[model samples]
Target: MLNTPVTIIQPSDGWRSLDLRELWDRRELLYFFAWRDLKVRYKQTLFGVLWAVAGPLASMVVFTFVFDKMAGLPSDGLPGPIFYLSGLVIWRYFANALSAASNSLVGNQTILTKVYFPRLIIPLSSCITGFADFFVALGVMLVLMAYYGILPGIAMLLLPFLLLLTMASALGAGLFFASLNVKYRDVGYILPFLLQLWMFCTIIVPYSEVAQRGGAWRFVYGLNPMGGVVEAFRWCLLRGAMTGPGNANATWILLGTGVPVALFILAAGLLYFKRLEKMFADIV
Candidate 1:
């Protein structure tokens, strides 16, 4: 009689033992998760994908009026609509990805309890659904850039890296929250309020405004990963035309400072998630 083969399953030994090979082999599962999320996002919505475009458009109008007209905030020299829209494009992607990823494991508790795949796939895949909305909103940003005669230069090539940075920052932060949320549940309530404060600290206001306050505030501003990303977005799309000469170096400084901080967050989040990954099946 031929012996039937049996496989053994075990938890990974260390934080560094992420099993990248397994993750790569199971890449198709990631695609399915992302597709399911994309479909579900618009499942019953009347506007469907147009909600992606509408959201940024509506925000641009309000931000332009409130910040530009009422408060007289500086947009470097860029027009108010385009300025706000650029930041909005990046901010919206990060916000949506973070929100979804934080809830991903809990929301899929049935699958968490029943099946096995790279648990990392759940949070990683959750970040991808927002890219659809991101691209849709980006089209609107392009139109605004054309209207304002802002021709992107060689710097535009860096847009992909900027987006990758945004994704990294979101995934890193989301991983930490996703793991905590499985146990705490308060993350669901706290995340919305947290994002509101986070947005205010990003390029919602010119980084120059924050710099004026002094070194201490500038240091805090530099620590926010999204702040550098938003400024970098404007630099890439507007060719440094978004800020006056004085503020141009400030954008570079923020970018310089934010990259390392973002990487640190990714590493820290990964470590925390791995530490708790074993408990997810039992507790969740």
Candidate 2:
């Protein structure tokens, strides 16, 4: 009888490293996790996917009324709905992704205890699940833009990059919190308040307001990361419709400042998450 070779699997040594190739090889599992999250998200819900469209639309209406009509918050000279909805969609995605990803470890404790796949896949799938709602909300945004005859310019081409920035920021924050949540659990409680404060810090108010500071304050505001994302989206999609003073320099400054901050967060999060990945099954 011929003897066949045997294979043995061993844990990696030293600091945890992200094996991109292994993740790629397990892409099918990632798809399964992402798809499962999508189904589970809307499962048994009356509105199903319409909840996605409704969330931002309803927020847009409330903001338009409160900010535009009641408080008379400037929409950068653009119609209230479009201005508010554009920011809402991007903000909604980030908030949702962060919330879900942060909770993913505890939420899927059963799987973690029983499975051997990469732990990173869990939070990653949560991020992708959130994108499903984002795209749906994006469609609603497009319709509103058409209703107001707002046309996207060549800058609109930057949307994909801008979106990547949003996702990176969310994932960075999400990973950090998700790991912390495993041991502390307090992170889950604080996330809502944090996100609320974060929203106000972003361009839910007009970017023009931030630009008015016109110095270090504006630069500091740029460090918020989502500020850059909101401005980029508005610059790309609402350029022609915008009615306020434009600052090409401020836009560049925000993007420049934001990109580095986001990158730093991502790098830190990845390292922290990797450091904690081995303990997830035991802790969770």
Best by lDDT: 1
Provide the TM-score for each candidate, comma-separated: 0.93, 0.93
- Residues 1-284 of candidate 1 have per-residue lDDT tens digits of 37976767776575535879889989999999999988788888888999899988998899999999999988878889988999999999999999899999999999999998889999999999889999999989988888888788898889889889999999999999999999999999999999988887785688767888999998988899999889888877886465464355876899899899889989888889988888898998
Each candidate's number of clashing pairs is: 0, 0
lDDT against the true structure, each candidate: 0.88, 0.86
Model 1: residues with Cα > 4 Å off, grouped in runs: 1-16, 246-248
Predicted candidate 2 versus true structure: per-residue lDDT over 1-284, tens digit per residue:
36975756678565588989878888888899889988787889897988888888898899889988999987788888988899999999999999999999999999999978888888888888888898888888888899999887888889889888988999999999999999999998899999989987785677678678778778778779899888878878888877667455557778898899989988888889999898899988
